[model samples]
Target: MFFSFVLCCLCLSVYADTDAVKSVSVMEGDSVSLESNIPEIHQNYIIKWTFGHPENRIAQINKEAGIFETYNDVLDGRFRDRLKLDHQTGSLTITNTTGTDSGDYQITIIGGKKITYRFSVTVYAPLPVPIIIRDSSHCSSSSLSSSSSSSCSLLCSAVNVGHVTLSWYKGNSLLSSISVSDLSISLSLPLEVEHQDKNTYSCVINNPIRNQTTHLDFSQLCQPCAIRGCDSAEAVIRLVVTVLVGSAAAAAVAVLVYDIRIRKAELETIQTSHRPCTHCS
Candidate 1:
């Protein structure tokens, strides 16, 4: 019983060592070669590859002829026309790749003993073109009264990559930002008005497979305040003053006309009194 227990421990150690497999990373639309140092045997050996999980079989190698056999029902439609395997080299090639093709891959070697290899594949598409836009609006009156607070926002997007992170910088100083699972990133910045703060802003996006960056000049991002309440107040004051002056002028003319009519009546009465004396003569 003691000898049997020692032998069992030894077997377990060997099994654990052989179970260790190296992971491989490959880009989209690239070819990957898989080679193993396992001893070559006369007996027929079967090689199988699966994506994500061992249950999701992608392709299997023929034991006798050493050719790759694929199952149409299990294979994904996007990888239908794109996948190719070399029987002799045991290499797999994936032609154009989409974001959904990125996942874990497993390779199984079945012969006298079963050997397994794990591979991690990541596919990256081109980065999306970036665009920069600027807006200057005040949040409160106190901010404007103290000094002009210039605000701006930056937008960045990519084509076929997922789980992206975006960061913003103004002459090396980081600004506020937002990110999503989609390929787009947006950042909002509120900068104090200063001579040195007139530097350009930059937006950077990154993923496990690829990275991209964009820069925008400060001149393009500096926009004046759109709602100028101070200008509107000046216009209202001018309108009120014009209306008051017109009203005062009309009142003065009416008082002068009343005084003139009273003077004319008094002069007519005195002239009538002098005419009565002439009638009596």
Candidate 2:
């Protein structure tokens, strides 16, 4: 009978350990509130709160003993001013969340036995206003021809953005994107030569917390003079000239060496003929 009792106790302990509640979610701005249903077995237990992925206990409340303990090192400063414990409900509230406040959190209960609960918190900041700047040098479409291509780039500026996504759009469709703490830049794309009369480009910056956009008209973009097959022809002509000059130089050097060798041979034959013949009678 004693053996059976020990077995049942062991089973109960295992079940209690697995019954701990855990919840995690992202909170907006600088505050977060969490609530969980407490089991009857946990009524007499002490609730402990912790931060980090594995849930290191940072603060605790002893319900029966009416005692509270906190670890300042584990709790972030931004959370320190805003962290509050509801002793009655065993819930946790955090305010004034900052970028550094994003992380995992946990709650542990200590009573006749020990039970643990865990949660994760994420904080977000709003997107900043986007600024549009014209890039005239790279914005020229007239520089492009049937045999040539031209590129144009535009600048988008913003500030104080946190975890926000930036994108470029032509109408409702996305074109390109670049992310920055304050702004989002767009990459240079091919501009239509005929579309220079139309204004149809914009920058879109967004985050879960906020969003902003900037627009560009055709006049703000670059327009270069169009030349028919000028770029390709110029490149081909330059290459051909380089090759021809190199070949001419080589031919000139070969001709000079050949002339020098022929002259040396002729002089040697003339000297030999001018020498007195030993067999002359």
Candidate 3:
């Protein structure tokens, strides 16, 4: 009987805790309110707000005792002056929230009855605009990965983004994606496409609440690579130049041979004409 009673109490505690918890999400530098449905709150009633596992008391109010206190200085002054309390509803608002402020907030009210409210709050940093750039390393590599003269190598990237995803989309179809949760992470996703492709492509960086997109311009980023070999006009020009140079060299050689032979003949005639009587017999 004791074991059964203990089990029943445990189950009831779990159920009540789950039922009272509400989820809240906001961007960094934004404000979020944790609502406590204690209407007509006055000094005669006591409302206290606590946070985190140990549940440090951060705020409280009591009208009759003239006590309205917010202990924002507990956690290294993280809360500081960014906390606001609605005395009428006993709701607590946190302004200029940072990721460090994300956690569970619990409010305990003591008036006619004791009531507790729980909140799970999350603060996410703002997402940066994603950019698309040519992946020049792949484009200039000597291996098969090189951006062949017909293809474009590209990458979509974003820096200083937290709790977001970077994705590549072709038309309406998704190509690839990467996600990061660290406070300031850089992410990149690669894509390859034909230079002449006419389909639409875009890079996107998105968080749960907002997104930014950059469209790909094939014509602007990846112009057509000129073919390596020459065209017919270039080939014809080379052949003509070769023939003219060969003809000019052949003519110069023939003229030099003719001049040498004529000079030899003139020398032979002069020697015969001047034959003296050295062996006149």
Candidate 4:
């Protein structure tokens, strides 16, 4: 009996790894068709498609009667509306897939012998637009040198991502990339870049189905002087001079307002003094 049990386990392992098993990946809200390894179905054969464990059947086909049925309450859910079975080939199609639909799917074909085919289906959400932030939190103008001024640091981040890659790119060239194989988590990548005008940098977040890139314009983010072809020191001096000139103008205006107020008060006093003939009249 032990030997028989061991043989059964081996056979099951072999079946699990058979070429009959297929792996499929799809984006959320998309449709996927899981083709049966069996090229042809006989009238006498019964085809069943199941999810998770073998007994949790989701769909079944009766070739002789040319009918397919989807079970409700199998996992307290139903695939009847979105599930389709190709009776001739015993293939299954699921439409408008969701992340919850990712799991092991198995098909059992019972004819003169029972054959099982499995599929590993994965559904991924569309990646959101990654955020690119310039890290000026630690940078200072007083500590900056020519070499330090030529470069800038930035961070790219995405939230609640799984089985995807977050990559940093300078034009078409890849600079860095990171991925977490299993659990969904917030991911981030830091990048240091030497300022260059001709090439644009970008952060790309992608899965198998879709990708989004956030483009970086260096002239806008890094060098304020490079945009105008002016010296950085000259730009600072010009800014200081502009502020001083504005302050001086404001002070001069204040003095003129004070002088006007004083002259009006003096004119009122002179008019009052000249009109003191009220008692005499």
TM-score of decoy 2: 0.52
Clashing pairs in 4: none
Across 187-217, the per-residue lDDT of candidate 1 in tens digits comes to 3333333423657667766655566777876
Better of 1 and 4 by lDDT: 4
Q: Would you list the C-alpha lDDT of every candidate in the order shown?
A: 0.58, 0.60, 0.78, 0.78
**Candidate scoring better on lDDT of 1 and 2:** 2
lDDT-sorted candidate list, best first = 3, 4, 2, 1
* Candidate 2 backbone collisions, by pair: 30-97, 138-152, 139-222, 142-224, 158-182, 158-183, 159-182
Q: Which digits, one per residue and each the tens of the lDDT, describe model 3 over residues 13-88?
A: 4434535578888998999998776445644478899999988889999877877788868788889998899877
* TM-score of candidate 3 against the unseen true structure: 0.67
Q: After superposing candidate 4 on the true structure, give the runs of residues whose Cα lies further than 4 Å from its correct spot.
A: 1-20, 78-80, 145-147, 224-281
Model 2 misplaced regions, further than 4 Å: 1-29, 37-42, 53-56, 68-78, 110-114, 139-153, 157-162, 178-201, 217-281
Q: List the lowest-lDDT window of 10 residues for candidate 2.
A: 183-192
Task: State how far residue 215 of model 2 sits from its true place (Å).
Answer: 3.7
What TM-score would candidate 4 get against the native? Answer: 0.69
Per-residue alpha-carbon lDDT of model 4 for 44-128, expressed as tens digits?
Answer: 6788888986458888888788767877667657564788888667889999998888999988877656778888999998788
The numbered model that scores best in lDDT is 3
- Which stretches of model 3 miss by more than 4 angstroms? 1-20, 42-44, 141-147, 227-281
